[model samples]
Target: MQIVTRLIAMTRARKLQRQFQLIERSIVALPVRTRSRLAIMTLREVGQASKCEFPHLYGTAPEQRYMPWGQGTEIGFSRAQSDNAEVALRGIALWLAVAYHETKESPYTSLQPQHRQLLRVLRELRDAGAERDAMAQWMRSGAAA
Candidate 1:
C-alpha cells in the first residue's frame, strides 16, 4: 500500500510539472508587447479586486468599532473612513503595473525607486485604516477625466 501511495504521489507530481511547463511555454510564446499589455490589464484587474471590501465589516451603526488586539489602537473605521486607504493601494497597484510593463523587459527585473515609493505608500495606507479611501479617490479621479 505504501508503495502504491508513493507511486500515486509521483504521478501527480509529474502531471503538475507538465502543467507548469505548458503554462511557461504559453507565456513565452506571446510577443513582448502583448505580454506587457496583458501585465497592464492584469494589474488593473488586481487593483480593482483589492478594493473589494469584506462585507462582513459592514454595519449601519453611526460609529462602529472593532479592536484588532495586536495594533492596540481600536480601529474605528466606517466604510466612508476607509475609502481613501483602499484608493491609495489600488492606485499604487496600477502604477506598479505600468512600471512593470514600461521599465524592464521582464517583470522579474528590479523595481525602480518610484515604484518602490508607490509600494510604500500603499503599505502605509493599508496600515493607517481599512476604509482604503485612497483607492476610491484614484478611481474617482480616473472617472472624472
Candidate 2:
C-alpha cells in the first residue's frame, strides 16, 4: 500500500510538472508585447481585487473613450495612455492568449465579436509598424505621448 501510494504520488507530481511546462511553453511562445499586456492585465486585475494601488501598472484615463481590453471599463484608455503602443499591443495580445489558453478554443470560436475585432485592430497596429514607431517616439521624447 505504501509503495502504491508513493507511485501514485510520483505520477501526480510528474503530471503536474508537465502541465506547468506546457503553460510555460505557451507563455514563452507568445510575443513580447502580448506577454507585457498579459502581465499588465493580470496586475490590474490583482490590484483591483486586492484594492492595492499600482501606479506603474495603472494609467490615467484617456481623452478618447475606448475599451482597451474589449470587455470592461476596468481596463481601458488609461493603459494605452500611460503605457506606449507596444505595451497596449502586448496587453491586447496577452488578453487573447489567456483567453485562448483558458478556453482551449480558437479565437474565432471562443472570443466574442468585439474581442475579435479588438484583436484584429491590435494585430494591424503591430504589423503596420505603428506600435514600434510609437515606442521609438516615446523613447526619443522621453515622455509618454
Candidate 3:
C-alpha cells in the first residue's frame, strides 16, 4: 500500500511537471508583444473575477498598476487577496510569459534585472531547470516571431 501510494504521488508530480514545461515552451514561443499583452489581459480578467476594483488599472489607463516585466505596462494585482492557488498560479505564469518575451536576445543573455527576478519566482512555482530548458529550446527553434 505504501509503495502504491508513493507511485501515485510520483506520477502526479511528473504529470504536473510536464504541464508546467509545456506552458513554459508555449509562452516562450509567443511573440514578445503578444505575451506582454496576454499578461496584461490575464491580470485584468483575474482581477475582475476577484472583485478587485480597477478603475485605474485597466485599458490604457496611465495610472494603471502593472508588473515590472516588459514595458511595465501590463496590469497586475493590487493586493494579495484570497489564498486561491489558481489565481496565484495565473499571476506567476503571466509574469513568466512577459519576462520570457522580453529577454529574447539569447537564452543566456539580455535578461534585465526585473526579468531575472520574475524568472526566479517562476522557477519557484515549478522546476527551474525545466523552465530554462524550454526557453532555451524555444530560442533555438526561432519560432518566437
Candidate 4:
C-alpha cells in the first residue's frame, strides 16, 4: 500500500508539471517574465496587483495550492463594478492601440507612465488567458474605438 501511494503521488506531480509547461507555452508571446509565473496567486498578491482588497483575505494566509484545471475548465472575470474598471481597461486598450499602430495621432499619442504599466499588465493578463474573454468584451464594446 505504501508503494501504491508513492506511485500515485508521483503521477500527480508529473501531471502538474505537464500542465505548467502548457501554461508557460500559452503565455510565451508576452514580452516579460509573466509567462513563467504560476497561475495561482496569493490573496495579498492579488489585492496588491489589482489595488482592491478581496473579501476573502480575512486576516488569514490561505495555503498556496497548485490547482491543475482540466480541459473543460472555463475562465472568467468579475463584472459590472461601480468603480468603472471595464471602461478604464478599454481606454488603456485604445491608447495601447494608438501606440502599437504608431498612427501619429494626438490625444492618445502619448500615454502616462502608469498607462504604459497597465498596458503591459493587460498584455500579461491576456497572454495568460486570465482575461481573454474580458479582452473580447472590450473589443466588441466599441469602447476602444
lDDT of 3 by residue, 1-145 (tens): 8677556545533433443454555546555444554455444543543352432222233443463222212322211121554444354344344334434232322234444645554444345344555787898896976
Q: Which lDDT tens digits does candidate 1 get at residues 75-123?
A: 2111112346443333333333333222223222232333354345334
lDDT by residue for model 4 over 1-145, one digit each (tens)? 8677556545544543343344334334433333223222222233332331322122223442122211110111111111354432232222222222221111321223323443454456545555555576799997989
Q: Between prediction 1 and prediction 4, which has the larger TM-score?
A: 4
Residue 122, candidate 4: Cα error in Å is 18
**Predicted candidate 2 versus true structure: per-residue lDDT over 54-141, tens digit per residue:** 2222332343324222222224322333347555544343343333222222232323333354445335434535565567678889
RMSD of each: 17.9, 16.1, 16.5, 17.9
Whole-model lDDT per candidate:
0.36, 0.41, 0.42, 0.33
- Candidate with the larger TM-score of 2 and 3: 3
Show where candidate 1 strays beyond 4 Å. Answer: 37-145
Candidate 3 regions exceeding 4 Å error are: 1-5, 44-145
Judged by whole-model lDDT over C-alpha atoms, candidate 4 comes out at 0.33
Candidate 2 ranges beyond 4 A from true positions? 1-6, 41-140, 143-145
Q: How do the candidates rank by TM-score, highest first?
A: 3, 2, 4, 1
lDDT of residue 102 for candidate 1: 27
Lowest lDDT block of 10, candidate 1: 68-77
TM-score of each: 0.25, 0.29, 0.30, 0.27
